[model samples]
Every structure is written in structure tokens, then in C-alpha cells.
Target: MELIDSAARAQQALEGELGGERMILNMGPSHPSTHGVLRIVLELDGEEIVNAWPDIGYLHRGDEKIAENMTYTQFIPYTDRLDYLAPLANNVAYAYAVEKLCGIDVPPRCKYIRVICTELARISSHLLGIGCFGMDVGAMTVFLYTFKEREKIYDLAECISGARFTTSYTRIGGLANDMPPEFLPMLRKFLNELPATIDEVDKLLTRNKIFVERCRGIGVISKEDAIDLGLTGPNLRGSGVEWDIRKAHPYGGYENFQFDVPVGTAGDCYDRYLCRMEEMRQSIRILQQAADQMPDGPWNAPEAKIVLPEKKAVLTKMEELIHHFINVTQGINAPPGEVYFSAENPKGELGFYIVSKGGGAPHRLKIRSPSFVNLQAIPVMAKGHLVSDMVAILASLDFVMGECDR
Candidate 1:
């Protein structure tokens, strides 16, 4: 009884010595680890996180409201700024959204071209994501390797779209122009070299002791939590959901290609990284399929009223001239209706809902950015983990503020 009383007194003394008030930490709208202008207010019990509040809106430019005022075609450039990492994919998603609203189907060739662009965008995006994930986890070699391949993708983007980063490549009805003659050859060469680079990166970080220890079993989100929290993209799949927007709702001719969605069993940071790595490989497969099955036809739809006529005809013919003038002065005349179309972007399901009141501009334009949805899961995932693990968690999420804040 004397020893038991002493033990109880010792326990109380230890608790009194060790415990204190919780701390409130600010992680930044400028911290490099945050990946962009994202700030998180973390409530901490020493180094362990008790709760997290993601404070977004630092990079907001009112993109949705801007879309309501501008023409659909005019807003294409703005889409580039949404997910700046995969501008081509953003352009494709927005263009498809407008096309769906207008009830127009672009030609088969256009669809295939779009698929090619979208997949390349996916590969490009995953490269940077994987590189940054490695960098955040202290694997610098992987970052260098992925960055080199990413540069090649940027070259391809510049070749195809005449803009490297914010590529406003897609149009309301089709592309700005057909693929340049040098594009396919360069793309083929890049594909040939890409696998080797991916393999190199895989060797560097896939089973690295430090990387694995830092990521595995850290920031784990259950499959149920992932779905309920509306986590999309790799973050969602990393939770073993297997809910890929491409496979579920094929867009931009994704149905024509065959690829696998990489789902994770652990739903941790390591699993998310692995999912991205595998996704890059699947994107390569889709790219190869698209290249082999390249179609031949008009790149743009034949709709004269909404689609601008060819330059040759516009100069010579009055009807074509008038259509061109209206297409330039105003935007395409979309029917009075509402439509929501989303594409499986590299980040996740990028959805655009348009409420059109029979005009060139939309009455309401709403963007469902995956970054925004995925960022919400941070609070749940970061709970009970050390503050240092926050870096890996944020990296695994791989979200950009451009789209999230927009």
C-alpha cells in the first residue's frame, strides 16, 4: 500500500512536469514546405498536431466570377492560371466544359489530340509532383532527375501551344491549331527517354531508408475518410478508393485508351507518392496508344455560327466574314441551359459548372478544383503526427494554390 501510493504520487508529479498548454503554430502563406501561398493554422501538443486549419484564398483572383463576365473563349486563357502546372489539362477541361454546354462535339481527330495533350499534361504534372515530393522528403537526386524530364515536357508544350507554361492551347470548339509537324516526332523521342528517367527516380527514392521511414504509416487516411472528405486525384486513390474520374467518366476520348489507375492500400504519404509514380507510367501508356492511333480529320467542328470560319474563307466570303467578326467581337452563342463537365486532371477531377442564359457569357460559372477539395483532408490526415511530418503530408497531397485559391 505504501509503494502503490508512492507510484501514484510519482505519476502525478511526472504529468505535472511534462504537460503544459497547447501551442498554436502558423505554417505559412510563404513557407516553401507549404508548396505555395497556403497557410495552415496548427494546434499542437508539443511536436504532435492536435488539429489543423488550412487557410486558403491568398491567391484568389475571383476566377469564377470573372468567368461569368467574360466570353467562354475569352476565359480559356484564365483556365491556364487555375492549375498552372498542367495548363494544357486546365485548358482542355474548360474547353470541354464549354463545349458540353454548347452541345457540340469536336471532331474525332480533335478528341484524340485532346487526349494526347491531356495525358502529356498528366505526365508533366506528375513529374514535378514526384520531384517535389522527393525534395520535401530530403531526396535531392530524384528532384533533379524529374526536373530534367519536366523540362522536356515544357519544350513539347512550347512546340505545340507556342507557350511553355500557361499554354492556352484549347479553344471553345477545338485547338488553336493542329499539332505542328515537329510535335509527334519530339513527343515520340521524349517518350522513349522518359521511362528510363522514371526508372532512375524509382531507384532513388522508392525504397530509400530515410524516405520510407519518414513517409510510411505517417499521415494515413482511411478509405472511408477519403471518400467522405471529398479527396480526389492521387490523394483519393492513395486511400485505396480506386475512384479515378477518367475510368469512371471518360472524357476527351479517354474511353478509347486503356490504362490502369494506381490505388494504394495504406493511404499514407508513401502510397500517394507511389500512386503518382505509377500514374506517370500509365500516362505514358496512354500517350503511346494515342500516338499509335493518331486519327486524320478536321481539328475543329464545322459549326459556322459559333465556330469561327477559316481565315481564307473569312476574307473572301461575306457570311464567313460576318461569322468571324461576331466570333471575334463576341463569343460563341451557347444555348440557354446549365451544364457541369469535369475532366480527370493530374490533380483530380476538375469540374466546371456553367449556367448559361443564352448568351456568349455565362450567368454563373463554378469551378470545382481538386486542390480545394483535397486540401480539406489535411486536418484529418495531419492529426496526431509530428510537425515535421506536415511537409511530407503536404507534398503527398500535391496541390497547387492557383487552382485551390481560385
Candidate 2:
């Protein structure tokens, strides 16, 4: 049969079976159930969905266009706003791009620090994303429990970078600052305690009959479909694909880390949730290794012209004054080149493509936002699922509006 004929016959059969009683529902643009500003137009027959169309761009900020006008250093802060749940991942992505463009290699110590901060960011993102999903699904206690741990991670972030949500601590060559004395000890504590917390959360939701029934079979996307649609992170892993950017590309010395990329056999909300939970444990393991094997050295890449001068040096030395003045006033001029850098961001493959025209500012900068691409799968996955499951699927996808619209 012709494709159009087959589709028409299927529609005819469906409509005849339902007696033309189909209802349309708008999921959100402002609905509290949606984690961010997203709208899904659903065509339903009673409780079962017939089709779903996702309407996006409700949180568009034009961040990529703004980056073209801003200098490389100035653009770093904007990256933080993308995946606010994992701001450090945004920092790493943008910094990785600039570093690649300028051919800058970070010191071993700086790399370890980067790993620690990025992993913490990953854990923080999963905490909020999964925790909120629990609340959306009527498990309010899970939300509170998740946030309790998330807050601890955020506190650790603040201790390290002086900010929680919008930490632009990563600079082009390396980081904006060095790790403090107390940061490691606190992180070690968190690392030690995290497994137990994860166990509690797992026991709370993973095995509950109600939670399983709601999640186990809904929103199933096959591995081929996931890859074809450019899905990454836990969503793809839930579909049984073992492709992780940290392992596949290994930027920022992720190659040194020994960890497992957990995959789920069934591509469903439950599988995605399980993937994230396992990911948090893996991130903690990475952090423990990083903290243990951390090297002692300057955190910033040792380039006086590109890197900012120390305040003490600027005060004490006249030559330092000249370098500082040139760096801040004129800004760092990257060579005429373009580079694309991708990292294993919390959301997925957060990547930045930077084009430098051998000037103080970038000629063009584009972000390959994971949330934006990950959200694309919604229309496909959400179609034909119940309206209530729409919320579950949305939470499972974990789309951050800032990154999507940016």
C-alpha cells in the first residue's frame, strides 16, 4: 500500500473506533507542571494521546548572536545561563572551545579541578531535574530529598566559585580562580555521603509499584531512534546506547578517569531516571579520584598576555601593570581560526563552536546546546502517550529553557 493510503486507513480506523470523540489539550507555556517554558499540543482520545506537537522558543534569549559581539572572556558568563542547573558544564564547554581555538593546554592540576567542578555540576543538575520530576509525579518527598542533596552540592559550588547558579569561574585557558583549602575536604564529605543518599532515593522511587507503573513502559525510544534524533546524555543511555562524550571524545583529561557509563535496556521514564541516578554516583567517583590525585601548580594557564594578572602582581610590579592593562583594556586577541569543542555536560553534549578573526573578540560563536537538541525528541516520544505521562516524559527529558532558547 502507498504510504499516504496506509496513514489514511490507520486514521480512518482510529477515528471509527473512537467515534470521532478526540480532545485537544495544551500542556504548557506557563503550566507549573512544565519544568520550564514549554508547550505541548496534545491530540487525545479520552486519556490516551493520539498525537503531540511541541511548541518551543518561549524562552529564547539569542545568546549565540550576543556572543558574536562580545569578547571571548565576556561570553563565558553568558554560557552559565544556559543550563543553570549545571552552570559549570556551560563554563567548561565555552572554555574548551576558546582553549582549542587558541591551542591552550591546561596544567594537570587545573584539569583535575575542572573535573571536580564539572562532576559536581553534573550531580547538581541531576538532583534538581530528577527531584522535580518526582514532585511532578506526586512524590513530593523525593523532590525535597533531592533538593537537600542538591543544596549541599550548590553550597560546595559557592564555596569554590562564590556563586551557585551562574558560576562563570572557568576562563579561556583554565579557571578564574584556584581551589581553596576547605573545598576539597567538604567535597570529600559529600562524596562519602552521596552513595547513601542515592540509595535512599532509589528505594523511595525506583522500586515503588506506583512509580514503576507510571514510568517503566511509557516514553520508550529505541536506540536507533535516539541516535537518529541526536539525543544524548541519560536519555540516549536509557535507550541502551553507551555513547558518552567524556568517553567518546575525552576532552579536559576525562580519559584519566575510571568510571562506568551505565546503560538501561528499556527506553522509558524509569530507565532515564535510573541512568541519571547511576550518573550521579559515577560523577562522585570521578570527583573522589580527582581530589585524591590533584597536582600542585598554578590553576590558570601560564600565559601572561591571555590570562589575567594576579592582583598582588599588578600592585607590586610595573610590568604586571602593563600586562593587566593590555589584557583587560584591549582583551585577548585569539588567532584567526575556528574550533568546535564538546564536553560531557550534565544535559548532554554541550559544545561550542568559536570563530576567531585574530581580534580581541570572537567573530562568531555558536553553542550546540544539549537541551535544545534533547527537547527535539519530545514530539516523537510524547505522541500517543497519556497526557499525565507527558509531564513524566518532560521531566525525564530534563530540558533547560535557558539552553534551549539560547
Candidate 2 lDDT over 1-406, as tens digits, reads: 5556777867977778635588888888998777789887888877888888888899898898888877788888898899888888788777878888888888888889989888998999998888888888888888888888988988998998999778898987878888889999998898888888888989999988888888988898998999999999999999999999899888888999999999999899999999999999898889989999999988888888787777889999998899888877777888998888888888888878888889888888888888889888987887778888988899899888888888
TM-score of each: 0.95, 0.94
**Residue pair clashes in candidate 2:** none
Runs in model 2 deviating more than 4 A are 1-18
How far residue 351's Cα lies from its native spot in candidate 1, in Å, is 0.3
Worst 10 residues of 1 by lDDT: 1-10
lDDT: worst 10-residue window of model 2: 1-10
Clashes of each: 0, 0
Overall local distance difference test of candidate 1: 0.91
